[model samples]
Target: MDAVARVRWAQVGAGGHVARRTSAWWERLVAAREGRAPQRLVHAVLEVVVDGSVRSVDMAPTWGRSAGARRVVVTGPVGSRLLGWWPLFRYELRVVDAPAPPDHVLHVSDDLPLPADVLDDLALVPALTWGRDEAGAGDMWTSNSVVSWLLERHGVTSVGPPAGHRAPGWDAGRCVARR
Candidate 1:
């Protein structure tokens, strides 16, 4: 609205962009634990496919820079946090194929309806959900409440309950289909 306010706003915007581009949690955690710093995060486009048709594209997290992470935590609300709910979905990532995701994600699977925590701990690399919400790309997500915030592109979302919920564990594998 004012000159000073505009300058402050621009500064804040630039800082936010810098933070997002920094190494993802997994990269920092693994590199620190191993007594080294990761050179970069591997960015990959998750292509959910079935019947040879591209179904969806989940931009996933900034941590996408790393390959071979078998486990990743999808965050959600944990009851009330005095102010209604937690501020930001604290997404914790564990590459069991790296180690330790629970300590960061906070909530555990024992409390939720699904074994989401464990599934994330033992998930296969490049996993996915069943498929399209069918309401068209715009409204297909069951509950994009959080993902709408994390996705770096166009504020994305997908089927609710995270991919691990419908995964049926690492053995059954994941799926991808378009409407």
Candidate 2:
């Protein structure tokens, strides 16, 4: 890394209750739409930061099934491009204006901000996944994986698939879990 090298990460806010509740609502809505029994709920909160300092936090539901629900769209390069432009997309933590690269950070107690793109595409699943993967919060991988599988099964070409894990992820091979 050089002096010009920079990195972007997601911010987990201390106030993410609203987003969590909203995510749970949307999860049920999607489950109902898919004719599946809703079991667990999900939420989304977006936090943007720079140099280990808080910038902004927004907490809200990720999905809006109702007509009046707000929509948020996030579009960025896929694959390796993400490595260079991680900050462009929603992440668990982001540091845009750091003088030096992040050496090692810890997940401290914090509030969760609202997700960036709550409507349209590139939301909910990815945002929640980030929350799970990076923030060590939200167990949304199974639900998100199921959503992607169902979408692909029905030939829905609106959103892409989830990253990591196989088709079922933790949802499958676990009888105690619900889909």
Candidate 3:
């Protein structure tokens, strides 16, 4: 493979239970050279902490640190994240540890509302998840692509593939389905 191709592949990443780094020098160096801020969604970003019987859910800062969260669960293979933190990225679900209290956690999944509490406590949060085609190169994509893809099962056409730099934003006037 060519040098440029290899570098792009590094950015797309492989997905199979990869853990996150406190720091990634290569990603940082590239960001510096590009002179661009990390890609992040300006939409729903919430924090949820599940303790014994009760779940505390709230809106989190746009670039909140999930490191402070206590426990995390994920549905699919995870990988290192280049942009800011979000529940959809699986960065929040990198481990399976017991929670102490006042914890933040995420469960990345193809399914939603996967039994967090005896009752429902699902709320919309600003988040993003990026993925690449199985080949992991120019086919890199992001955001609610899975949802868009799944729509096809229900007879909804996927208008187009997700944009490579997507971190879907929300507004009162705009609907996610239309994206």
- Per-residue alpha-carbon lDDT of candidate 1 for residues 19-50, written as tens digits (9 for 90 to 100): 33543554466568778744332211122222
Model 3 segments more than 4 A misplaced = 1-74, 78-129, 135-138, 158-179
Clashes of each: 5, 23, 5
**Residue runs of model 1 more than 4 Å from their true location after superposition:** 1-16, 19-21, 24-33, 57-87, 90-179
| TM-score, structure 3 vs. true | 0.23
RMSD of each: 20.4, 16.0, 15.8
- Model 2, CA-based lDDT: 0.30
Model 1 C-alpha RMSD vs. true structure (Å) is 20.4
What are the runs in model 2 whose C-alpha is more than 4 Å off?
Answer: 1-15, 42-179
Question: What ordering of candidates by TM-score runs from best to worst?
Answer: 1, 2, 3
Against the true structure, what is each candidate's TM-score? 0.24, 0.24, 0.23
* Candidate 2 weakest ten by summed lDDT: 1-10
* lDDT of every model, 2 decimals: 0.25, 0.30, 0.28
RMSD of 2: 16.0
Instruction: For residues 67-168, write the lDDT of model 3, one tens digit per residue.
Output: 664333322322334533444444332222332232121222121222333112121212333343332222222323333322333333423222332222
lDDT of 2 by residue, 57-93 (tens): 2222333323232223332222233452554332222
**Clash pairs (backbone) in predicted model 1:** 41-65, 42-64, 42-65, 42-66, 95-98
